[model samples]
Every structure is written in structure tokens, then in C-alpha cells.
Target: MATFDEINVDISVVLGSSEMPVHQLLRMGRGAVIDLDVREDEDVSIYANNTLVAKGQVVLLGERVGISITEVLMRSPEIRPMRTDGPL
Candidate 1:
């Protein structure tokens, strides 16, 4: 079993659309462009626990989505649970 401390997953920060009304939002159809609030060519930040961890480029692969890790912001030390055993 893998614990939270034993997992390493790639996370992404997505730019959200602003100034869009919820009523109009409900009318969005396929292929509609919902512009994200980010600049082009800008690095999309990825984080863990509110801490910046990496940056990546968005990519598409055969209708699937992917991210290419560009930089690592921080690499923290591993955490371990307390345990004690003794002869009885």
C-alpha cells in the first residue's frame, strides 16, 4: 500500500476565466473558447500544499491532455510515521 508520503504526482495550476456570467456559462457549447486569465508563453505554476513545486507546458496527445515539467521549485524531505517495536 502506498501512503501519501510515498507518492509523487504531477499537479497543475490552471488559469480560470473571469468576468463570465453563470447564465451565459451554461450556454457554452462544444469548441467554445473560454479564455483563461493567463498570458501566452507564460509558465503555468504547479504546487503542493500551497508551495510552488514545478512549472510545466500544456500539451495534447491523441485527444488526451498532458503537461511537460519544465522546472522544479522545491523538493522537500520525506516524512515518516513514528513506530517502535521491542522484544516481549
Candidate 2:
């Protein structure tokens, strides 16, 4: 069996997203704030290796920030199957 300790995965937390014109984006400087499309009470999406794995909430511990996992996402085995058919 292979040990999992040797593996590394990149984790990312997406709170929300926003779209803007290139001119507006280029005009931004330090201390710029781009509003996201999420509310304060909304759950954030957590991704592992660029795949959505779970959802969580943002937390603050002392002066540092953290994430509190509220739910875990699992893949349905029936939905994912090896495609032996010819490519489209």
C-alpha cells in the first residue's frame, strides 16, 4: 500500500466571484476592494486539487483566520464511470 503522507494537494476556498471590465480592473490599485456575490452567512466552497470537496464557513481565531467545515461533498460512484465509448 502507498502512504498518503507523501502526497500533496492544493486547497482553495472560494467565497464568491465577480466580473468587471478590463478598464475597471486595470484602474484598481492597492487597498482596492472588489465586492463578491456572496452574503456574510453563506457557506464558502472548498476545493482540493482544484476539485470541489467540501463547503465551510470562515472563522477567526484570535488574530488569525480559519475555516470551519460545515459539510463534505462526496462523489457518486454511479455518476462516474470509465468511458469506453469513442470520443465525441
Task: Specify the highest-lDDT model's number.
Answer: 2
Each model's C-alpha lDDT?
0.72, 0.93
Sliding window of 10 residues with minimal summed lDDT for model 2: 79-88
Q: For candidate 2, lDDT tens digit of each residue in 1-88?
A: 3777889999999999999999999999999999999999999999988889999999999999899999999988885556899784
Per TM-score, the best of the predicted structures is 2
In candidate 1 the C-alpha lDDT for residue 17 amounts to 45
Model 1 Cα shift for residue 69 (angstroms) = 2.2
- What TM-scores do the predictions have? 0.51, 0.84
lDDT of 1 by residue, 15-39 (tens): 4346788998899999988878888
The regions of model 1 sitting more than 4 angstroms off are 1-10, 15-17, 49-51, 60-64, 75-88
